[model samples]
Target: MGADRVGGVRRPVRAVAYAASGVLLLAGCASMPDSGDLRDVESTPRQDSQLRVFAMPPREDAPPAEIVQGFLEALTSDDPQYATARQYLTGTASGHWRPEQSTTVLAGGPDIQVDRTTGHDSGDDYAFTLTGTKVARVDAQQSYTPMVGGYSQPVHLTRDKKSGQWRIDVLPQGVVMGQSDFQRNYTSVNKYYFASDTWANSVTSATAVADPVFVRRRVDAMTQVVRSLLSGPTRWLESAVSSSFPAGTALRRGVASLAPDDQNRLTVPLNGKASGVGREKCREMATQLLFTLQNLTPTVDTVTLQRTDGGTLCSLKEDQTETVATRGSVKQPDYLYFVDDKRRLVRIADGGTAAVAEPVPGALGEGVQKLSAAAVSWDEHTAAGVGYDGKSLFVGSLVAGGALDAPVLVSQGKAEGDRLTAPSWDARGDLWVADRDPARPRLVLLEQGEGEPLDVRVPGLKGRVDAVRVAADGVRIALVVKAENGSKSLLIGRIERDEKAGDRPVVSVLELRSAAPELEDVTAMSWAGDSRLVVAGREEGGVQTMRYVQVDGSTPEGPPPAALTGVQSIAATEDEQLPLVAYSSEDGIVQLPSGAQWQKVTKDGLAPVYPG
Candidate 1:
C-alpha cells in the first residue's frame, strides 16, 4: 500500500510540469551488477536473461517418475517459455499448459511419492503426489498473499504415442518453487500509482504511491512490471488508492517492441481506449510508466505515450516531474542536526564539507550545554531532549530567541540503565515517549497544549516498550520492545483513536504485527518513506545490520548494509534522499547515503538527527 492508504490520510497529488511532478526513488537493492570477478572471490552468476532457460531437456528413455522429477527441476530454471519444463509433457499438453496462471511458494523441497493403480495400463502407470508447507501464493492477478498450511499437488503422466516417451498429461496451471530456489530467482519491485486528484483540471493535487510486487529477474520483467502497473493496485489497496488510466485501458502492441528511442526516450503505445483521456490524465499515466521502468532501465529519462496508429498522446521529461503528494515529497532539510562534544546542538549541510557543523542561533543550540539524546520537530522549530542523566525530558524552541524551558516530563528509573528514550514528534505535533521502568513500564503521548499526557494501551507486548516512534500519518506506531530474555523485538501496531467518548482524546493499539521477527535484537527504527521503515538490528550472531522492511510485516530480499559497530542511535525521514544517519560510539556520526555503504560525516557529533 502507498502513502494514500496509510492511516486513512488521503494523500492527494499536485500535477505540474515534468520536472516538479516526478517521484523520487533510491536505487533498489535487488539488481546487482550483471558481471563480476569470480576468480578470487565467491560469486553467483547474475540472472539477466529474457527467459528462464534450462540446459537439459527431458530424457527420451527415462521412466515416468524420473521424467516427472526432471520436469520439476526444470521449472526452477531460466528456460525460455519453460520449453524445457514442457518437454515432459505431450505436445498438446505443452501447448495447453499455462505457467503464468499462478505460483505456489513452498517451505522446502517437495516430497514426491509415486502412485500406480492396479488396473493402470503402460501409459496410465504415471501418477504422483507432492506434499509441502505453503508459505505464500501469488494469484493469477499477481497479488501476493502470505499463507500457512499443508499443500498437495497431484501430477499425472501419460506416454506420448508419437515419441513413446513419458510425459505429464494432467496437472494444474502455473508452477511451484522451493523456498531456497525462490529466494535466488525472484526479486521485488514497486509499481507506482496515483491518488485521485481532487483538483485535476485546474491544479492537480494527487500524489504517486509505490505498490511493491515480485517478478522473476530472468523472465520477461519489463513487460510484467508494466502490465501489473496498468492492471492497478492489489486487492488490499484498491479501496484507498486510485489510478489515472481510463477504464478498458491496455497496451497497444502488448510489451513487444516497447523500447526507448535514440534519445533514451521510452515510447509506449496504448490501445485506442486511451486516446480520449485528457492531456493531464495522459501525463499521469506517463509518470506511472517512468517510475515503473526506472529499475529496469535507468537510461530512460523521458516517456512518450502514443496510440496504436502511432499518433502522439503525451510526453513527460523525467527531470521536470516530482511525486509531490506522497511522503517522498518531504525533501531533505538544509542540514542534519546533532549534539557536539560540547553537548550543544549543531548542524551540517547535506553532502558534508559545506561548513563545519556549528551550533545554531537558538536556546537549545547556543544556550543549552548538557544533552544526552534529542529529536527535532518536522518544521525544525522545536527540539526535545533527555537530560545528561537521562532522568528528565525537556522541550524548547529552536528559533533565534527560544529558551531551554524546564523539563516537561520525567522518569524515575530503578537502575542506571532504565531511562527514557529519545522523544519523537509526529506530524500532528504530538510528542511520544516510552520509559523503560521495570516497575512501571508505559508508553505515553503528549498533545501540544496543556493537557495531561495519555497512556496508550498495547495488549500483546511481552515486555517493556523501549522506544516509540509515531508515523507521519499519525495512525501507526513503531515500538522497540525488550523481551524477558533481554532481547529486543521490532513491532508495528495500528493506532485506534476512540471517538465515541467525547471527553478527551483516547488512543489504543489493536492489531500489533512483528515487522522484523527474524532479527534477534532491534536497536532503532525510522520511517524511510511512506509505508516503509529502515531498521537497525542484529541477526543471531549479534552483529549489527540495517534492513528495509514494509510496515505490513514483510522484509525485502537482500543482505543488510555494511556493519556499523556501536551504533547508539539512528535517524531517518520520509525523504528518500536524506540517507540513514547514526551516532556511533567509535566514529561519532556516520551516514549511509545510499543504504549500501557508510561514510563518516563528523567526529565530534553525538546524537545526529534529521527533522521527523
Candidate 2:
C-alpha cells in the first residue's frame, strides 16, 4: 500500500511558546481536520444608489464630421427638449427635428463616415453615413418593439461661415442612442388593454392585459403611456388583446396635454373626435387612462376628458372605475400553496390570515410523502404532484382522502438524477408536464385526469423539454427547453389539436418562436397576463433575475417588482393584484403585493404555486 493509504498518518507542525523558560518550542501533531467552505448568508443585494441624470452636450465650434459626432452623442443625453443637441443642427432643421417620432436603440456606437468629396467651403455640404445594429424601435407613441438588423442613418451637414461651425442641414426624423444609455434613461411602462370580446354588457367582466412599452423616464412618461394605450397593443399582441379606442379615434389635437385641476384630478383636452364617442365608451376610455397613469403617479385621483372645442366628454374617478380589467381573472384566488420543508403541501391565506400553512385537507396535501413539485388546479379543487423520487406523478382532489388509488402517471428515469419538472394546469383543466429523462425527453398532457396521459410531440424541437406553462386560452404553451449547447431557453409554441387521432384530440407543437431571446438560462416561468410571461432566468454570464417579457421575445422596460435571490420557484395568479409568491433557500416563502417589497410568509418552503 502507498504511504498515504497505509496506516501512516500525515501531520502538521506548529510553534509553541514556553513562558517558564522564556523560549519558544516547536511541536508536531496530526494534521488538523479539514473544514468545509463557508455557507453564504441571505440578504437583499444592494441596489444601485448612484444618481443618474441626463446632461447637456457642450456647444463648441468644430469640424463638420466632429459636429455630426457630437450631435449624435448629444441625442443620448437627457437634455430637456434636446436643446443642447439641437445646436449642431441648422436653425431651420433644429426646429423641424422631431426626436419623438422614433428612437432607434443601437447595440453600439454608430460607425460614421463623412464624404469630403465637396470642397470644405462656406455653403458647401457633406453627407455622413451612420451604420449600427438596431436592437429596438420606440415609435412615435413610445411603444417599444425589439428588432434585429442593421440600420443606416444618412445625414447632410453644411458649413456656416458666419459662425465658422458645421451644422446638420438634413437628417432622419428621430434620434439614436447606444444600448447603455437607452437602458438608464428609458423605462418600461404598461398600457392597459381589454379583451377583444369586451362589449357594453361584458365590460365589467372583461379582463385587462398590460401592453408594455418603453418611454423616457425623465420625459412626459404619463402622456406617452396613455398615448401608446390609445394607439392599441403592439403587433405581437394585437391578435390577443384590444383597445377601447374606436376606429378613427384620435386626440382632439395632435397630442393631448394633461394637467391637474384644483381637485388634483387630471384634465385631458382631446380633439372634437373624442366627443363623438358615446358616454359609456368615453368613461371606459377615461378608466383606461386612469389605470395607465396611476402606475406612474398617484397624485391624480380622477380623470376628466374634454374636447378641444371646450365640450366635456366624460370624467371618471379612479376608485369608481375599479372594475376595469388589467390583470388576472375577475375573482382572485384567496390562498397560494407550496410544499414546506417537511414535503407537505400547505397554503397561506391572503393578508396573513393564516399564521402557518396548514397541510391542505386532501391526501396529496398532508398524507402524500416525498412530494417534489405540486400545482393547484384552476378550480382549486385538485392538485398534481411529482414524487420526490422523480418517477411518480399523482393527481387528486383537495378534500380529505381524495387521492387516487395509485399514482396516475409514472416517468422512467435512467438514474436517480433524472427528474420530472413541476406540472402546470391550463384553463381547460389539462395538466402538463415534461419528463426530463435524457433518453426520452417529451411533454405529457393529462386531460383533467379523466383519461390516460398523452405524449405530445413537439415537431422540429432539437432539445430536451424542461418545463411548460399553458396560457389561459388553451392555444399557446410556454416551454423551457434545454438546448444542445447546455443552456436553457424560453420558447412559445402554438398547441395544435388534430382531430384525426381517434376520440381525443392529438396535440402537437407548431409555429414555435422564441419568447425571451435575452434570457440565457430560463429556470422558471409563469403567465402574468394574456400576452406576457413573468420569467425567472439569467442573462449571459449574469446572475438569475426575474422580469416580465412578451410572448414574442420583447423585454419590458420596468424593473422586476421584487428582488429574487436564490429563488427556487415562483407562482402568481392571473389577477395582477394577487400577491406574487416565491420560494427562496434563504428567505423561505416570500410574498410581494403590488408596489410592495418582498415579505417572508413562511420558513422552509419550496415550489410555491397558485391556482391556474
Candidate 3:
C-alpha cells in the first residue's frame, strides 16, 4: 500500500490486489441485489465535514431505556428545529418542551439508571434517573456562566395504547448535553450596547460596549443573534448598559428569517414599539445593530432599520458607524510607552521599526521621580505612574513643560510589595487602581483623575487584589487577586454606579466570577478586545504560557500566541491590530507584530503599555 497526503498530512492507504475484481465491483456499485426480501438500510449516523450531525428516529416498539437514550442523542445533534427529538416525546410533552430556554452542560454523558422500585413489568409506566456532574449553563439570553456541582433529573415514560409504543411523558426542561457536545453546537457572539454612565454625563462621544452571548452555530444564526440583541442586555449587564430600542420592542410578529441583500445591506423589521422613535434615536438603534451584526457577518456593509409598516426608520453605513458610537478599535494609539533601565518613562512610535526610545514629556520622563510601573490615558493626553518605592501614585500631562503634580494618591503599606498597582483609565476619564495595604486593602476610583479617591466596594471579593485593568467600556473591570495561600486567579466583575441628587455617585463592583479557572497563577493580563483578554499565566506544576480567554470563561478558537519566557508584565490594547508588547526577563521588552515573531523593542524596558 502506498501513502496518501490529505490536508498536508500523510496516511497509509490500503491496496486491493484484485485489480479486475475491483474494477468490476466499482462498475456495478449502483446495481442492487435481486431475489431477496426488500428492507430499509439505515445509513450510519455521524457528523460530516461541515459539522452537521444526523440522528435516526427510535425503532418501532423500542424499550423505555432505548427511547431515553435516543432522545438524549437527538438533543446533541444539529437537527434544525429539533424535529426528530420531539418524536420520542408524548404529544403533550412535545408541545410544552422549550429547548431554547436554556442548556445544561455536564462533564460527560449522563448516566441513566432505571428505577427498580417502579416495577417495569407491573404496568405500562416506567421510570429512570439521569445523573452527571454539572459544568456550566447557557441561559435564554445566551449568556454562559460557569458552575460546579452535581446534576440529577427524573424521566418518566408510558406506553401508548393505540400504537403500543413507549414514549417519554416527563423530561427535564431545556436541553442537557456533555461539555464536548455543547462546544460543538454553540458559538460565542458579542452584542453591542451604549455605556449608560458615559451617556449620562452628556458626553458627545458615545462608547459602544460588548455584551457577549452564545448562539447555535448552524441553526439560523443570523436570526437568533438579532433576536437576542433585541431582548436587551443580560441580567448581569443590565445595570451598566442601556439599549436604544424602546421598551417592549421586538421583531415583527411572524418574521422568521433575516439576511443581507446583494449590496450587503441588512434591513431589520421591528414591531410598532420601535416605529415612533425620533430620527436621532433611530440612528442610534441602527448603530447598535450595525456594530453587533458586523461582528457576526463582516460582509454586512450597512444596516437599515425598518418599522412594522415596512418603512425605513433609519439607515447607517459601515463608515458612518463611528459617528454614532465610538469603539476602542476605531481609535489608534500613537506611541507604546514603557519604563527604561533608569526607571524613567519613555516611548517609541507605535508602529515604527526603529529600536530608539525617547523620553516622554513632563517631569516623570525628565527623571524627576523614578517609576516602577505606569498607565497611559486613553486619550494619550495624561499619564499615571507608580513611584519606584510603590508608595505613591502620580498623574501628569504628556506635554512639554508639564509639571509633575504631587502624588494624587498614596499608599501607607509598610512593605514595598504591598502598595499601589499600575493605574488604568476608562472611557469616562476615570482612573482606577488597587491599594494593597495589608491594614486596609481597597479598590479606589478617582473621578477625572482629580478629587478624593472613592473606595469602590467589591461585594464578594475573598482575596487581595494585586492588579487592576478597567475595560474601555467603563462598566467591566478585570482583577488579578491573590488568595491567602498565595495563589493568583483572574476574575471579571461588573462596575455599577448609582447617582444621587447632589452628591457623587456611589460605585461598586458586583458579581465577580473566575475568568481563568484552569490557571493557578495569573502573572499579567490586559483587555485585548471588547470581551476578550490576553492572559500570561500557568497551571499548577506547569510552565508559563500566554493565551486568549473570553470574559465569559470560555476559550476562544485557535491556539495561544507564540510562547515567551520569563514574562514579568504584558500589555495589549482593545484594538487588536496593534502589536502586543511584553516585558520579559530573558529578552527585556519585545513586541509581537501580527503574523510575525517576537522582535526586541528595547534592551532594558519594562511595564510596556498602550493607551488604556
Identify the candidate with maximal TM-score.
3
lDDT of 2 at 61: 50
**lDDT, candidate 2, at 167:** 85
**Which residue pairs in candidate 2 collide?**
188-557, 208-325, 251-271, 252-270, 252-271, 328-574, 328-575
Candidate achieving higher lDDT, 1 or 3:
3
lDDT of 1 by residue, 1-612 (tens): 111100111111111112233433221211111221001101123333332334356544666656655666666665547877887787778888898888787777555655443224644456666667887777776656566789876778776677677788877679886776666566667777754322342143455556667777656677677778888887555543577888777788544646677999988778887988888778778888887788567788899988878899999988645632333433457678888877787777773435577776677777454777777776677778777777877778777877676677778896646878878886556788888777778887777612577887888878998877776655567888898998998887766666466777677765666777668899878777666787888888866787888765566655555678887787777776667788888988888877457888888878777775
Question: Which residue pairs collide in model 3, if any?
Answer: none
Better of 1 and 2 by lDDT: 2
lDDT of 2 at 497: 63
Among all windows of ten consecutive residues in candidate 3, which has the lowest summed lDDT?
A: 5-14
Better of 2 and 3 by lDDT: 3
Q: Per-model C-alpha lDDT, please?
A: 0.68, 0.70, 0.82
TM-score of 1: 0.72
The estimated TM-scores of all candidates read 0.72, 0.70, 0.90
For model 3 the TM-score comes to 0.90
